[model samples]
Target chain A: MQAGTQKSVLIIDDEEDFAHTLAERLSLRNLAVQVACSGAEGLAFMEQNLPDALLLDMRMPAMSGIEVLRTVRQKYGMLPVLIITGHCSQEDHDRAQELGVQGYHSKPLDFKELFEQLVEVLHQK
Target chain B: MTDKHFMAKNLASSTHELQNILAIIKESSCLVEDVLQINGKPRMKHGDKLYHSLEVIGEQVDRAKVLLRALNSFAHAVSDGAQTCDLVETGKQTAQLVERFVRLKEHALQVVVENGSAHIACPPEEVIEALHSLIIQAITACTPKAPVLLRLGAQQNGQALAIIEVAGAAWNPEEMEQLAAKAGGSVVLAPGVCTVQFPCAASL
Candidate 1:
């Protein structure tokens, strides 16, 4: 993907507001962003669409971020995945890193940093 | 099993939800700011005011995050029966959670740590509750806008003392004694001050 070119990004989190606002922000930055409110919905979307990058939340109602990441790593090993969390522990960080996350971030995020990371991952992918 | 545990569980869940809510507000406000910057706001009326409003929203979200963090810590205070706790950190956390309470009563609450880290052995939830109750009572009884000072100090013989001083409020010796006993500490009273002393877990 090149700068100023269209890129697809998928965000998986149960937080509707965060997902939508993040999508809007990414769209403003010229990326086509889609959101899934649950891990099941996220996996469903991935079957039909191949996003350039992924933003995943660790805590969800069904199929946790780790589970989603595991499935993604198994099916789409080369995809760039970034972990987002609110109540992250050391165990979560180590686990995500072990499973090959591109980056890790905590909630109340710095959007500029996220945008930079997103672009960097898209470029790498 | 206990009510405190139940309340802690509820608070933990609720604060997690609240964090999600704050994340949304944060991103929405950021989106507004992004739009303004991308469009250059040259032709839009009230663009400056709108940007300022978004800034205010972002600031309030930050403030809410702090309160939620303090509340979450308070919620987890009941997770253990009795443990070694940092007196300074715990007092600061308690003060942050009830800062609003003091403000709403038109009184001021200030937390001061005169000594370095002091470790105490106690049920953290009970200590927090006792501090909250005493502060609220003092704030309510004191003259409007008077300051209530919460000071933490380390003592000899491996003890830590927390002093609650209300400038214009009278002391309640009997109630203070009960509160101190319930919190696993002893109380000392001055004209408008109540002090609770706890044994340090490490020293014990």
Candidate 2:
């Protein structure tokens, strides 16, 4: 936990229910959670309310999660980013690894494990 | 790749979509469970029942995930026209694909690997189809309580063999030559057996 206030997390995922539901769950832990339903929207949100960490979904139309990651890396290099994907190929996984993402997970995610990883990443800041 | 690439691609896409759907359901279920545990315990009246039911949902989700993964894997066989694959694993996957059908018939399916692992070079989908056809035949011929055994191993001359044994089997192996040839393999007919054998040392 941070010193005084709740740590904030920004979730970038096109899946509306998945993003909001997860955000609501994390909010119960006393953290501020925001959801962006698209890569563009997430980037736009980050321009002002840069959260402590990011939960990114890999597959999206127009601008993909990897594209968003690339932009974030260039703009906010040290921010912790965890990838949550429905179906990612080996090539994409390797690319994410090369880009030095904090973590990667598949769909029908283990919420407990995801929360633990999120906490660990937040504490590192 | 085979002509089935389009179909496989569609299946792969559908599995991903369904996976996302499952994820949302799982998270929504967890959210409900979380609310019920606000006081570090469940609701006063139906908390325990709700928790148990949630557990059942979780287990079913896990089960459905396995089937989805298998379907996705089966779709992936179209990635190449020819490749080397573990025969034992292929048999197990084939068995899983036909599980519901076997259960409806009250038949058992088992994969038994002998001595060592068996590797075969061929279009994996073709082998699966061949094995699938054999299993159907085995189910029809075997005794009600008998199992359909998918046995895989290496031949004496470094060849690989996979056989499905049926009780009271009577299908002539010659009937499967055209089918087996599609997999670069052959069939051996016996009193209660149908074996598909391939030359491991060679590749087409």
> Each candidate's lDDT (Cα)?
0.82, 0.81
Candidate 2 collision pairs: none
Candidate maximizing lDDT: 1
**Regions of model 2 farther than 4 Å from truth:** A1-7, A49-52, A120-125, B1-3, B40-48, B76-92, B108-121, B147-172, B175-178, B185-204
Separate DockQ for every predicted complex: 0.57, 0.65
For candidate 1, write residues B122-185 as lDDT tens digits. Answer: 7777778777777887776766688889998657667798888887787677887787788788
lDDT of 1 at B81: 46
Whole-model alpha-carbon lDDT for candidate 2: 0.81
TM-score of each model, in listed order: 0.71, 0.76
Predicted structure 1: lDDT: 0.82
- Model 1 segments more than 4 A misplaced: A1-12, A23-56, A65-83, A88-106, A110-125, B79-84, B113-119, B140-144, B152-156, B191-193
Q: Mind giving the per-residue lDDT tens digits that candidate 2 earns over B56-129?
A: 88888877876776676677666533476667667677777877777788877777877466777866677788
| Chain A TM-score vs. truth, each candidate | 0.95, 0.95
